[model samples]
Target: MANVKFDHITVRYGSHTVLQDFSLDVESGKIVCLVGPSGCGKTTLVRALLGLNKPETGVITVGERCLFDAKKHVNVPAEKRNIGIVFQDYAVWPHMTVLENVSYPLKKQRRPKEEIRERVMHALEQVHMTEYARHLPNQLSGGQQQRVAIARALVVDSDVLVMDEPITNLDAKLREEMLLEIRMIQKRLNATILYITHDQQSALQLCDKMAIMQQDGTLCQYGTDEEIILHPANRFTFEFIGVSNFIPLRQAGSGLALDCGELIPYTGEVPPQAENGGFDLGVRPNDIVFDPASPLKARVDSRVFLGSEYNYFLSLGQKQIRVQQSMLDARTRGVAKEGETVGISFLNTRFYPTQKGEQTP
Candidate 1:
């Protein structure tokens, strides 16, 4: 496996810049996930890395080899880059059987027939698709077809594997199963993976490191899942990766006063350079603590059963907050009915300046 690097990369279409001065280093034998919203340049960045698109400026390198360098006028073709790509569509030939599909890449290299058959069979067994080796793509289920596609990519023994939302089409159960299988395969092969997906859960589960991008193709934040969750670099990154409850507040004497017209204690110092006007207090749903004896009160607006937990929507006068708890005690957990008053406290909270009347913090 080889390390991949992007240095001051820029990609544009007409006058619109899709990616701007983006740079990232992906270490060898590690899984890195690229995550963002629908219009974000996640896909564009992956395409560029795969050598499908050339950047207008900057350079891309896989180990010591320069894949793209504008000043040097060097551009490596996609097929010559030796990178494997698993697209969301599976990209399997309908008429080809599983074995033939997996062996196609070996055929391109003109390997011996026996060697090709051995590699293809081993790859199929790796993905547990050996039982259906002779089955056509049309005869396999979506999950089986996806396995065949993975086996095809694996058979070539490419060092770098790029998968773009490969499991997005599967059902919840199948998606989980596929994720486990993929993780096992990657561990066994020690392959370098660059995964692109909008699903936060998938990224959190699979990626060793992750980068969050904006619609303009700019890198917002790149870090471990824990770092991004606990210490978000910006307001946008905070809301996108996890659930956040925004409580409007204004600076008071030494603390901050809730827009609910109540004063709440703060444990940390708010920056003096903070913008004027209202500020927002961010609290995760799981961080909200409920106590029957506390003074701060809220009424239960709604509650929903979520299998392992119960989601509660609590209303404090005109403001609404969400809280989640284990599904152990139906009496205590479910006791808070609609309009029932109860005390509330936050386990942790973050502060940020309000933006455009929205509590992005």
Candidate 2:
């Protein structure tokens, strides 16, 4: 398997710049997810990788082959790049049967019919779509059609697989099933996959490495799932990747004070980019506990009893926050009713710069 590299890539349309000086590397045989808000250039970057959207500057390489380089004036055609892409819409032709769809690429390359049949069937087996090889696209379910799409992409035997919102069309349960199936197939083939999605949960669960892009077309942060989750680089990262509470802060002696007048002891590693010697306290809902002795108080506004836990929406002053508690805890200590008061304490927290959009102090 070959690694994909983007070096100082930039793309623009007329006066609007889509990506600026973006550089990232997807390691060989690794799953990397590119996630961000809508219109953050994730799709544009993918298109550039596939040679569909040519960058105005910089270079792109898959494995050892340089596909695009502004200095060298080299731009390879998309078809010649040998990159397989599974699009969000499945892109399956309505008139074609599964076997025909899977073998279309090979047929276009003038691959021998016997070899095409062997590879197409093997690809179908990988996606568990062998039984539906003769079925037309309209005859299959959404998930089955998606499997056929995957089979088509795999039949090319590309080292790098690019998936663009491959599961958005499926129901929640079906999405989960496809996620697992895709992960398994990827591992079995050891294909380096670059998956793009607006779904943070799927990105977190599926990718070994995660990259977050901002609305301004800049890569905000990129690292392993654990690194990004536990140590977000900025306020945007904290708020975007997962559910987070942003508590306003004030200077308090050597440490910072919360809006609710709770003293947070100073730590050496204050987050970069906070203003006025202030930082925003960042904590996940699950880390916010119900502490009777805690000074912070909030009114429960709503409660959602998920199968394994209860998510409580609480109002602290005018700001709202969510807290999750295990069902076992709820049974042992009855959950606070809506409109009831509860004490709040943070089990863990991260500090972000008080100012939004600032990457560093």
Candidate 3:
């Protein structure tokens, strides 16, 4: 396994610069997910590292090899880079059996038949797909097909494996199973993986560290899920990582008030920076609790029971915010009807400094 480096990388198309001065270091033998929205240059970065796209300025290195260096005028071919990529669609051939698919890379290199068989079976075993070696791609489940795609990437024993939205086609249940499967495979091989996706939930479950990118191709924050979620670097990181509710705040006499159509007195402690004015109070859905004795009132617009939790949409004055309650909490406290007016209070909230006159969304 190798540590992948993207040092001061920038990629452009025609006159437009899609990626600008992006730098990230994927530690050796660890899974790092590059998560962001669509058109955020996530795949562009991957392509540049894979030698498929030339970076305008930067250095790309894996292990001891320098695959690309813009100043040195060095550009390795895609095949010689020794980096494996599992695409969004898996890209397995329907006409080929699992063993044939896994062995194709070696066959292209014209490796010894005996060597191909050994490596192919070993890769299949790593993904727990050895039993279905003879099965065609069409005969396998979506998860099983993904395993074949991963096994093919492993046959060459690349230093880094790139999974780009690899399980987006799977159903919710299958997606969870595949995430666990990918984690197990990574552990068994101690593989250096760069998983790219727009899905934060999956990234939270699979990454050793996560790199968040903004829509304008800027790297927002890079850290463990806990670090990013609990201590967000900025408002973008806070809103992007989880379910967030933002309420506009303004100065009301000696204290603060929520600008939710009506001026509701904020009994919560105000952070020092937000004391002067114009800040958005960002709260996670789970942090908002119902309080019968509280003056902060909101009308419940809808209630949904999601097996393990309850999701409620509440309208506060003219603003709407989401609230989630665990099954135990719902049963202990009580559930709210669609038209019921309830008092809600925030627990852990973050203050986001905004432009002085910025209106609420």
Candidate 4:
């Protein structure tokens, strides 16, 4: 296994910069996911690591070997990098049988026929595609073709695996199944994985570490799933990773007052360095509770049935807040009828200073 490192990397096109001074490290044998919105340079990072794009500055290293260094003028070819990559499109050879596709990498090494066949069959079995080994990619379902692609990547025995939105094309159930399969394979192989996706749910479920990027290619935040969820660095990090309700607030005396005619006790001290200006309160949908006894009240604006739970959109004065409750709570407590009034309480509240329409640290 290899630890991948990006040191002060920058990429530019013409005069416009894409990624600027980006640095991150992927620890060996750990799955790290890079997630962000479209045009955020997630793909650009992957391309640079894969030797498809060259950075205008800085260095990239895998383990102790320097892969790219602008100062040293060293550039390693993709084929010599010894890394396995699985694309979102399931880049399988349509004309090749499943077994043949899995064995393609082995053929490049001039391995003996018996050993190659053994490795190919083992890889197919690992991905549960042994039954379809004789079938071509055209004959298999999307999920099966993806499994073949995984098998091909695994059969090479590479130390690091890079997957680029591999499950985006699958149906919900199939996507879940593939996620489990990929996790199992990674565990079994102890492979260091760098997965790139825009889906926060997938990143939460699959990666041990995650980094969020911006449109300008700067990294907004990088940490474990829990850290990113509970302690978002800014508004963009909060909104990008999950659903959050932002309520306007202002400083009043020693405490903060909601702009909407309500005042909740502030448990933490707002930073003294924070500009004496507008602020916003952030709470996730799951962090808001429906309490009938609470003084703060809201009218039910809409409701959505979400299988095991119900999501309610409530109007608190002019502000809208979303609350999630168990299906049983919805049924027993009686669903919040449209225009019906209900009390609201914050389960976990946080305050941030807003500067020029952006949340500041």
Best by TM-score: 3
Q: Which regions in candidate 2 have their CA more than 4 angstroms from the true location?
A: 251-278, 327-334, 356-361
List, residue by residue over 251-286, the lDDT tens digit for candidate 3: 889888899888788878877888866888999999
Quantify how close model 1 is to the true structure by its C-alpha RMSD in Å.
3.1
Q: Tell me which of candidates 2 and 3 scores higher on TM-score.
A: 3
What TM-score goes with each of the models?
0.90, 0.90, 0.94, 0.88
Candidate 2 residue lDDT tens string, 1-361: 7999999999998899999999999999899999999988988999999999889999999999999999999999999998889999657998999999999999999999999999999999999998998899899988899989999999998868999999898999899989999899988998899999989999988998998999998888999999898888887888998888877766667565556434433333345554345667788998887877777778999999999999999988766888999877788867888999988777787776567663232
Clash count list over all predictions:
0, 4, 0, 0
Per-candidate RMSD vs. true structure?
A: 3.1, 3.7, 2.0, 3.6
Better of 2 and 3 by lDDT: 3
| lDDT (C-alpha, whole model) for all candidates | 0.83, 0.87, 0.92, 0.84
Local accuracy of candidate 4 as per-residue lDDT tens digits, 1-361:
8889999999877887889999999999989999988888887888899898999999999889899999999999987777788998657999899988999999988889999999999999889888998998899988899999998888877768899998899898889888888889888878899999999999889988999887778898999999999899888899889888887666667666555555543334344643243777788988877778777778899988889988989887666788888877667766777778887778786667665645322
Q: Which residue pairs of candidate 2 clash?
A: 272-361, 273-360, 273-361, 274-353
**Stretches > 4 Å off in candidate 3:** 252-255, 331-334, 355-361
Give the Å shift of residue 89 in candidate 3: 3.6
Better of 1 and 3 by TM-score: 3
Backbone clash pairs for candidate 1 read none
